[model samples]
Target: MSYFPAFLKLDNKKILIVGGGYIAYEKLEHLLDFSSNISIIALELSDNMKRVIEEKSLNFEKRGYQKGDIKDFAIVIVAVDDIPLQARIFAESKEYNCLCNSVDSVDYCDFIFPSYIKKGDLTIAVSTSGASPAVAKHLRKYLQELIPSSIGEFLQEMKELRKTLPKGKERMKMLDKKAHDYINTWSSK
Candidate 1:
């Protein structure tokens, strides 16, 4: 499947996670960096997962999946290993018209989570459409090594400069040239 690139605004949004295993913990760790309003519903939670819940003060409900658990959530992440359970959650999430991601199961996912490299506000996400996660991970590793840590600062600088530039085709041309020049200078130094 051809995937479109999009950025989600999850700040203060309610997110639901339907598992507490290692995969669930990994998903929670990633989400914790974005939103604090996360609710985890699972039959049993791992020690590390419980610690994270307590530390983040996240809402944790010790229960099995229910039909309407995903009703009010903006996004639902199903990290459960059971295919049947994942399918059930995916179906329920569709009824609520919310985005759902089933871990390692692209067929059940509304969107696939990419292997990402995050440095400050700069995030580089690499995905291979679930064809090969290892390839995506490898690409992420390469990007991590190639991309400078100062990219976040550079992006901020560009944003600030763009606001002051004239608004027209000229502005677009100037921005493109300036970006190229900045990258060239950055790599040379």
Candidate 2:
């Protein structure tokens, strides 16, 4: 099924990750930049993972994931290798009306995490509807090379301009024009 792509504002949002293996660590690495309010539950974590939790002072429960452990979080990510456990978590998450994503299991996911390129405030995401992650990664790399480092600074400038501009179609037109002009100039450089 095709799904609409959206960028979620994760600042201050509670996110739960149920696993502590390499997959879970990889997800945590990305999530750390967006949200500080994260909770991790797993029976055993790798030394590196434990160090990260300790250094960051992140909330961690050294136990296996429970059925209702996901009830309080806005987003839940299940990265365990066990398919049955992932499925169970996906099913149970529906009871709490929370968003769930089981790694590599699109059938059990409420949302798929796309391969993305991030530069300061600018972000570009690429996905192939879970058909081919390698293609998504390649596209992300291509975009990374295309988007200039100055784009982040340009985005900041646009944000400041947006605040000063009046709220109406005129403001949107000006913003779009400014952004278009900036990108055109950037591409020429």
> Candidate 1, which ten residues in sequence have the lowest lDDT sum?
180-189
Error of 1 at 132 (Å): 0.8
Model 1's lDDT to the true fold? 0.88
Cα lDDT tens digits for candidate 1, 85-179: 99998988878999999998888988988889888778878888888889999999988987777788888888887899879999899889987
Task: Give a tens-digit lDDT track for model 2, residues 1-189.
Answer: 777899999876799999998889988888886777989999999887898899899999999987789888989999998999989999998899889999998889999988988888887889998989899999899888878888888889988888988799999998999888878985786
The 10-residue segment with the lowest total lDDT in model 2:
180-189
Give TM per candidate: 0.89, 0.92
Winning candidate number (TM-score): 2
**Whole-model Cα lDDT per candidate?**
0.88, 0.89
What lDDT score goes with residue 64 in model 2? Answer: 94
